[model samples]
Target: MSSLTVAYAVAFYVAAAVLVLGLVVKIKQYATTPSPLKIPTMPAPRTRLGVVLRILREVIYFESLFKSNKWIWICAVLFHAGLWLVLARHLRYFIEPVWFWVVLVQPFGIYAGFAMIAGLVALWARRIVVNRVRYISGPSDHLMLALLVGIGFSGMMLRFVERTDIIAVKAFFLGLLRFDLQPLPAEMPLLVHLGLVITLMIVFPFSKLLHVPGVFFSPSRAQVDDAREKRHLAPWAAKLDAERDSAAAE
Candidate 1:
């Protein structure tokens, strides 16, 4: 393998390792953290099953976001929905004999890229134009949006303007999975798209993009409104109570 191929292969391997391990550590932290109070949002579910259903709706439909702001919800849903389709379509690259469902959605994924870009652009504009949002926005926020926009644009260019050897691209990714390196296409657009993707992966666990997993860990969404029915005590708090009772008995 050429040095360029080796470099890209190493880069991808390192990025994947960081992304996976970083997320695992963060998720473990989230799981172990204690919430000592029942602080679910108003109109929250009461039962565990209800909480599960509510979380599902929140994840799949962005129900809370929809209720909070229609325009933001629209843009977010469009981008996320498009991203889902695009990612599913990409499964073709990793596996031999692409799944039937992937083949079915292949065409839609192409157009979904446009929706993703449009939504991202609108969201970035909102951060700039809306004074309230702009006040809270930081450099990282703008940079993340810029990175996604760059990724989308470069990917679109590859599809429409200057097509690269997609077959080689698939081979490269499949090779990565099989522990056999393959030559990656040297197209500028493909390189830019890949670099941005790797950057996104590296920063994802630490950045606001952690909202992907953070949503599930959020007390407001994950907790049930059961303070009235039962005592809500964290493990540490419960242990303290037990110690207090033992001391009183002594």
Candidate 2:
């Protein structure tokens, strides 16, 4: 086996193992922690109308993303669009015989790679130009984006420049899924491209890039719509104080 083959295997396993172990450790930490900080629940709006408006503003307008730098939002949109197309196009790997739809899908896959590369570049540019972003931009952020962009660019090169054999590559993937080590496409370029992609997938769950998933779990977003038609919590805080005093007197 060539050194490239070994590199492919090593990168894939290292990534997979780290991703799994990281998730287990993270979950354990979250589970064992007592809630040390009570989030001061914001005052619920006074009127049902106000609550509805707030919900509409948050859910529809994505007020949180907008509140952040505009470039962040742009990067997010392109990243999502690019990722979706890549994953969707990859389904062709498992399916036998080219469907008529794949013809339409081909250009989209190329476009997706371009989008990912552009988004990553723009995001990196923001980190360089914006003082706040620059301060926060750590090694993991740079590494993550670099890996993603590498995967996108390499894949593009394999498709356009090198013209890798898709069928043999698909067979190799299917074999791997079946726990068989079949001979992969001999195309070094495509293998290198896929290797980086597998690495990104492995590291993704552990990285701050996980905010992609974390947004759904965020308390502010989760709690916003649920606060409808309740009394303002600022008033409730006072009421609770009064109750505590009454209890002391008793």
Winning candidate number (TM-score): 1
Model 2 score (lDDT): 0.69
- Which TM-score value belongs to model 2? 0.70
lDDT of 2 by residue, 112-159 (tens): 878978888888888889898899989878888788778888888887
- In model 2, where do residues sit more than 4 Å from their true spots? 1-63, 97-104, 224-250
TM-score of each: 0.96, 0.70
Model 1 backbone overlap count: 0
Please provide the root mean square deviation of candidate 2 (C-alpha atoms, Å): 5.9
lDDT, each prediction = 0.92, 0.69
Clashes of each: 0, 0
TM-score, cand. 1 vs. native: 0.96
Query: In candidate 1, what are the lDDT values of residues 57-78, reduced to their tens digit?
Result: 9999999899899999999988
Model 2 lDDT, residue 103, Cα? 55
